[model samples]
Target: MDNRDAVSAFLRSRRERITPEQAGLPVYGQRRVPGLRRGEVAALAGVSVEYYTRLERGNLKGVSDSVLDALAQALRLDDTERMYLYDLARAAGPAPRARARQREVRPAVRPSVARIVEGMPELPAFVMNNRLDTLAANSLGRSLYSQMYADSTCGANVARFAFLEPAARRFYADWERMARFAVGALRIEAGKNPYDRELSNLIGELSTRSDDFRVMWGSHDVHVFRESTKRLNHPLVGVLELDQETLSLPDETGLSVVVYSAPPGTAAEDSLKLLASWSATTGQDQHTESASEPSDRHL
Candidate 1:
């Protein structure tokens, strides 16, 4: 995607969301526009109309940090939104550098990282990277996402599974909220690593294929997904309400482990214990049935 287009669209969208009343500008009468006029924003930002217009038109190269801050203040942008504005400016700047690209996930897993996941069998835990590739998962974690894991071709793509896959609609209890969180997380990831080729491709594909994804993506919203509460339906274990946390791996770039657990005495917690028991009994039954079955030669 062209950085200029991204910058322009993002700024325009943010600008359109605000009203003169919100910005403390008096709305004299019925206006032709939805948001503050160019001159009004410039005046509030302490910049000339021409300069502000240029910036909004995607000319952010060589812009001063102070001016960017002032513009951010004028727009009443939040911390994430302000950071996203700066990210776009830096990406569009003349002293250009390739943004971080997430191509293929590193093939080899860190042994210690795997061990940590294995140690937490009671907790559904897995590792993913900036590109939302699910790198590693414990047995319980795998079970928790059996709907996703059942498909061998899932290939660790969270966005695809979350939105494109039909099963996901039933799996996630709060589908709309999950979609928002997914798109917002992706936006944050893009700003953090503007040149991520894999991420860019995923975004492009989603934009082309899904109208819902396209609309949300165009909003330029960003959110850090460090923690969340999720409600999921598991075929074997039934529904579970889980709280999840994403923990960064200091030694690995763009890598984080996500773990989910339910509080004790909750229905979800009980369901997990029952699932464990059922899995053990199912394993034993399978083994016993295998013993009774005839071999190929006998057949």
Candidate 2:
């Protein structure tokens, strides 16, 4: 969780996976290792071997933004990977100038947003934070995630459920895919707000409790949950395949609303209709998830 450990692990993992040939460098007959060496990456990034070695050794304090970008490029980082690199560097480098606090999520639940969800009664929709905390859900959204409300604790966190609850694994047919998305989203948040006390504690608890979470976290496979396909199991309506659209609130920080829909005439579409019906009959409920899952798994 420290910058030093995060930097060392992230770079080492990325470097170990990329081959010299893939970077278009000559593999030559005598090469033994699979990926580019430290010196090789340093050369590609236009930095001295000694400096790059220092960087890899957890000495990222005072590293320049340009240098970080160079390393990201040399490593052939994707959007998520590149962002994570910068986040780590930012965390380790010089103290940031104090500025206004950016919550990044609209705290107010807009009436218009609720109206929109109400209009699409058949679709399952809800709002969540960068930290994956559920803020609001429409009627159908409540039914779609009925299991989440099976408990008395009016509030529950999804990440806690995904890793700690066995039912979550069973609930999500595509458990592994969902889990990866969860990890990726969490990674992005970690980079965005490294010092968030709750987040830090959550990560710490998970790291101690879930081996799988820790492994993926260490790998630093940062990702954004902009859009995704999901498979959900419903008690009354069976299973559904829904296409989801996640819209970030431009007016707020860390808040985004997601809606899940199925094309007309599909069974999933019909299932969604059933969810709405169920919600109309049964009042909305609350969910309490197991928040003590371990977060340790080798990435």
Candidate 3:
């Protein structure tokens, strides 16, 4: 997508989500649009209506930081969204060559990183790139995401499984909420790595195949996947409520380690133990099956 189109879409989406009352502006007349009018936004941002209209039309090439910040405030944008605006502006500038070089370098998890994941047998740990591709996972991690692994063609993308796979509805307790969060997180990644070919291809594929994905993508939402509480409905062990922590691998650029854990002496902890046991058994079965089928097929 062109930088102008992305910037315009993002600005319009943000503008369409804020009402006059929400922005502390008086409702003067019958509104044609759902949210703040262009004139109202321009007034709030201390800019002319024509200038704001130009910005909303995707002319962000020479936009100043003060102007962007004022626009962000006027739109009531969150931190992620504000940063995304900056990213869009930067992408519209003369940085395409640097971005292209970065995209050409594919990120990989180091052997030491894989060993770290393996060492965390008690916790469900996995390494993922910015695209949410599971580069490495422990046995428990693999078992926790069994549904995603069930479809070999889908690979190890969390976003793909959440949006494109029907089994996700059964796996995630709050499937719709998780789907939206996944898409938002993907959007944030896209903002950071605008030239990533794999990320773009994955997004294009999901947008084409999944209506839910397309809708979420159109929202222009962005989120940081730092830490959260996730509830999962495991097919073998029933429900599990786990605390998820995402740690960035400093040496690996776009790579991160995601670990799921439960507090001690809680029912969630017991469920995790049961899941570990089940994972062990499933691992053995998969090993036996590997002789006949492809060894790379996850359990």
lDDT for each of the candidates? 0.73, 0.72, 0.80
Model 2 residue 262 lDDT score: 93
User: Which wins on lDDT, candidate 1 or candidate 2?
Assistant: 1
TM-scores, all models, native as reference: 0.86, 0.84, 0.90
Q: Identify the leading candidate in terms of TM-score.
A: 3
lDDT of 1 by residue, 1-299 (tens): 45777777777877888899899988787999878888988999999999999988988888989999999999898998898888877776543333333324353447778788767867877877666667677767767776666653222566767777788888889887788878988887776555666677788878887888898887787776645788999888778998888888888877788899898889999988776566555552111010111111100
lDDT of 3: 0.80
Looking at model 1, residue 100 earns an lDDT score of 39
Residue pairs clashing, model 1: 99-195, 101-196
Backbone clashes, candidate 2: 19
Per-residue lDDT of candidate 2, residues 1-299 (tens digit)? 45687678778878878988788887768867757899999999999999999998877888888998899889999988888887777776543322113332236556776566556666777767777766666667767776664552333467777787667787888887788888888877776566565667777877788898888777678777655678887677888888989988897567777889898999988878777766676755322122122223211
Cand. 1 TM to true fold = 0.86
